[model samples]
Target: MRVFGMGSKAWLLNCAILFACPIAAQAAQDNGHGKNASHAAAGAHVHQISNHTTLASGAKVSHALHTASGKRVATRSFGISCVPYARQVSGIQVAGNAWQWWDNASGQYARGDRPETGSVLNFRANGHMHLGHVAVVTKVINSREVIVDHANWQSGGGVSHGVAVVDVSEANNWSAVRVELGREGTFGSVYPTYGFIYNRPDTGVVLASVSRPAPQPSINPVPSDLRPLAERPWRTMEEVAESPSTPRHTIDLGINAGVSR
Candidate 1:
């Protein structure tokens, strides 16, 4: 295994894990319709492809998880109550498919090789880069619990949720995961701006154990986009708890009133 961040280099000798280093964009091509002959390690299991929103601020976002005909991909992210932002980053584009794949640097399918602790689960679009997220596989508990740590997750970075742990199973082909939203360590906010975990393969699981700093005052002014939500009535502790359903995915839960399915 190759490491990128934090100056530690340790190899997990069991399998050779090859990743597209630097996490940059690859050449573009039409999404996969052909069977990759060599790198058939089992394509990734996709969950759903629908969009998600922020719970607190009522912000809406979307990702590259759309179809060639421009349909919102179906995904289990919202259905299972697990945040889909990270999944979107991991290249699970179409919402309901649950099993898709993209090519790696060696021009093979993502799952062509066994994934490492901090591999960037990617989705391919016609041989080019379409979408993906940064995820650190935190655990491998009997195929029942494969905890992944990731942040800056949004439906295409539409809304931001902090890094979080999810329960995955191979039995379902890893298509669906049980997500733990608002689990404390997933996200961080600093006044008008926020920061989430980005693609950091060099520092995969090693950084998973690292804790985020407290939200600090930003040296820069807050962006104007957030002013309306930020200035909205501040909810008391009880008001917030009472209306918990109102803040799903940071979008005004009410925002989806007529729009939600």
Candidate 2:
């Protein structure tokens, strides 16, 4: 796998990219900003969601990035959505919106009202979640409860890891569930689900497609006075803003988390 690069860089990002690209494409499709409209039109569903990450005050700095050219550019990249994250991570090999995952997995993957580790919990399309949502089950706490890791769930494209999900279905089925909104003890509204799509990671197309370049990032000039500092002739406003104690690295990125690692 050429995409398998070396070093601490591969620590978290190497594996994350294999699944992140498709996820970003799904986002590009929904936002109608990219070339996936016709392809996305193949289905009406697949819904959307986000996570929590309060960007720096006064500017959305969370997704901002500085290119290698030292141009001090700004790229507004929202983090990964749930669909591609669930698909590639769970190896479900299904495409479309998050809501359509259940039907998409009809003959391809095993699904049911029960939760299982590594399974994709497919949420139904409802008034609240128009495109629907999908999450990768991380741990099954019990027959009626589980922990899931998913992106774009709370706010800022932040991935919520080991979040508790309680089954709220009347029949004790996992047809409906409420996710932990933030800190423990605070849960959100009841969400209908089509159940869990269970399967092992398919190393076929989904994994192979890690070779695809990350989604194109939206570029903007980093606001600066264009005055180079005496000590550091290349210093930009953002570079100056970063903590002086923080190590510096020039990272040119397109949508996959902005930071290299």
Which candidate ranks first by TM-score, i.e. highest? 2
Whole-model alpha-carbon lDDT for candidate 2: 0.58
**TM-score against truth, every candidate:** 0.24, 0.47
Candidate No. with top lDDT: 2
Off by over 4 Å in 2: 1-78, 200-261
Global local distance difference test of model 1: 0.30
Over the stretch 36-150, how does candidate 1's per-residue lDDT look in tens digits? 4222322122222333322222433332333465532322222221225445444333242111322222222223223344344332122111233234454332222233544
Cα lDDT for residue 107, model 1? 25
Model 2 per-residue lDDT at 207:
15
CA error at residue 250 for candidate 1, angstroms: 42
Give lDDT tens digits, candidate 2, residues 102-208.
Answer: 77777677666666788888888876578888888877655556667787786676555556666655455566666755432345656777777779432232211
Q: Provide the overall lDDT of each model, using Cα atoms, as 2-decimal numbers.
A: 0.30, 0.58
